[model samples]
Target: MRSTLRSSPQSTPAFSLIEVLIGVLILALGLLGLAAVFPVVVRQQRTAADQTQGLIVARNAEAYLRGHTLTTTRSVPNASVPGGGLLAPSDPIPEQNRRGLDILRYQGVTATNPYSTWSFNAANPDRPGPWEIPTYSLVYTNPDRGNMLVAATNQTAGVQFAQRDRLWPAAYSSVDTRVDDNKYANEPRYIWDVATRRVDPGTPSNVGDDGIQFAVFVRRIDSSIRVSRRDLINDPNDPLRLSRPTRDLRLADVLTGDRLGLGGVVTLQRAEHRVAVAVTNNSNSPVPTLNGEGEYAMPMRMQIEAIDDPDGQGLSRFLLPSSATDIQRRLLREPGQKFVDNLGNIYTVVKATFDKNPPNTSNPPEVQPENERRSILVSPAASANAAALAASGDLQVVFTPQVPAAVHVFTMEPR
Candidate 1:
């Protein structure tokens, strides 16, 4: 056959060594580009997911604040702490308890300090900060939420709350001044430190809560605004009452350019709106009826309500303390009386005290354009007009029989 098959077509020409190397180099470059692209793609994807979740969390918090806490009617002050009272950086609805949310509110209402938010206690009831303080709230048990103590600090493993035992003597140091003085003296310690993610050894958690554990961090990224104690207090009667800034306090502007608006940081605006859900249990109380707010915790205090009017008029109110001295006289002063609410739940009356105003003291002389003596509902700061009004007896007292008492309509378990 034409042995000229050309000897098997002379074996296909072998690729040159340089040509092969170039081909390999091209393939390697393609793979390198893909590898680089993968990380970027992953990062972008993660950011998008975080942002979406954040929006939901933020809105939920906003709704909760509006629903539970009352927003102070603000009137941007013209001067720094205009009334010269106990100034706080934030609007101190209760400078002493603005967001304290401690059940102690009901306890001390009839004491020397009519209300904690109105008074400052050096030994007990540690005041947190010009931060969001809870005055009223209801906590319910939700086992579905797992250990959240770890989540508060963004850690994989959480600190054992029970191991820490919130006893003030155990966890605190004599020289510890950064926290409230009553750091861990109470039971059911609730106030948690974000930096340490540990319960404040001095504050009360719920009546029987093992401890507070949350999945979301009370994420804050703003620099601390050293708010004046005078600024935070409210002087309802002071014509020159200092008010909050008309505009919102922004994190980026207050602290660094890098702020919570960016994905990796935390920030704080105020307490009313929470960015996360906070829960704890053992009380097994029913979830309070929430408003159109989001699924978030209200700045709440662990409160105990008494329904029995020892006077029987149903108008007799009680303000009992849980302090050492108060406990000794608990049965004598705050006699227990069984009561049933609309829900048919029974609660034992804890204390009974007069709802009448305390006796007026020899008014202290004015200091720095304001009164130095601040009572339970009294603000130290005042305006010239406030003084004139007080003198004329035209100044309206925040507390009076006119203001209706806050009695739980439904029945709740008594502490």
Candidate 2:
């Protein structure tokens, strides 16, 4: 065999400098593309997150308002409390830790920025001439006790004796002036001054003398009121119902009555009584009574009752019939009312029976001969007598939102 010089195949030369540069250039371009896309992705994610957070805050606020009934006492415009606005009467109750309403005073909404508002020292000694934001005068009273009839003194015998003594008078007597003079002298005066920006001297300045008194109380929506008519009808004794059956089927049937359409009557049985109560509108208006066929009256009692689920599933449901519409229109449909905040956020009130009956029960249960049912919508407007209730600070009720940071506060005056 010829030992041919088998020269090993020489290995190819390594890549040229130009080739190396090209490869690096390609890699750099790819890296640049990735860098460009990263910021866009991050921005989109951040925007989505912000929108979701804002939506959550809004929905939480709406649910909170719907879950509990609102009254002038607690929902006072620009009311203040320890955390912010006026504190609800139930604020002191331990059980209301999570369920109480928060009066969210909306400062304003910023598209891509944090929200801010004018601030002042409520207790600042140096700031002169009352804080810019008017302070509220809240007078709370016992509607039952303050307005109850009392034996008149011998001086006024012919007239039926009336309990002229107010449990929570809106203003302080000259002898009992505690807050500054410019401040509301009484609960009623305070609320009136704050709401209407006008001072009012309540009628009959003397104690034990009939005069306007106002009070407001705040209470959570008791679990009993949370149940729907169907649920209550099915299981009247459900612990969630928060009511009792004092009598047999006859009494139960009579109390519930045929108008309700449920075979058995569900008796709330003073459930309203057990609710945390507060009063507002203690200031005495020159008119004395807020008149409008008793409709659209302030200091109205807000009662909430779960209705028979239209879907028949025994659960409460809110439906939007219109698909292409704004939130305000949806919330203001028939059987519903719209409540807009200062920021123009709209809320709706769905129509439902507050009690087993279509209408509310007379305040004094005994006053009605057969416990007549009344519709809250159709019931007489808040009585002018409510002015007295307001003066005592008994008519104002405070509604505090659960999330303090998200609520907007503003005033809604009578139209």
**Alpha carbon lDDT of each predicted model:** 0.25, 0.25
Candidate 1 Cα misplacement greater than 4 A, ranges: 1-8, 11-13, 69-110, 113-129, 132-415
Highest TM-score among the candidates is held by which one? 1
TM-score of each: 0.23, 0.22
* CA lDDT, candidate 1, residue 46: 55
Question: Residue 30, candidate 1: how far off, in angstroms?
Answer: 3.0
Q: What lDDT tens digits, residue by residue, belong to model 2 across residues 195-314? A: 110011112121011111112211111112221123242354544334432212221121122112223323443321121112212122111111111100122111122222333332
Q: Please give the RMSD to the true structure for each candidate, in Å.
A: 27.5, 28.1
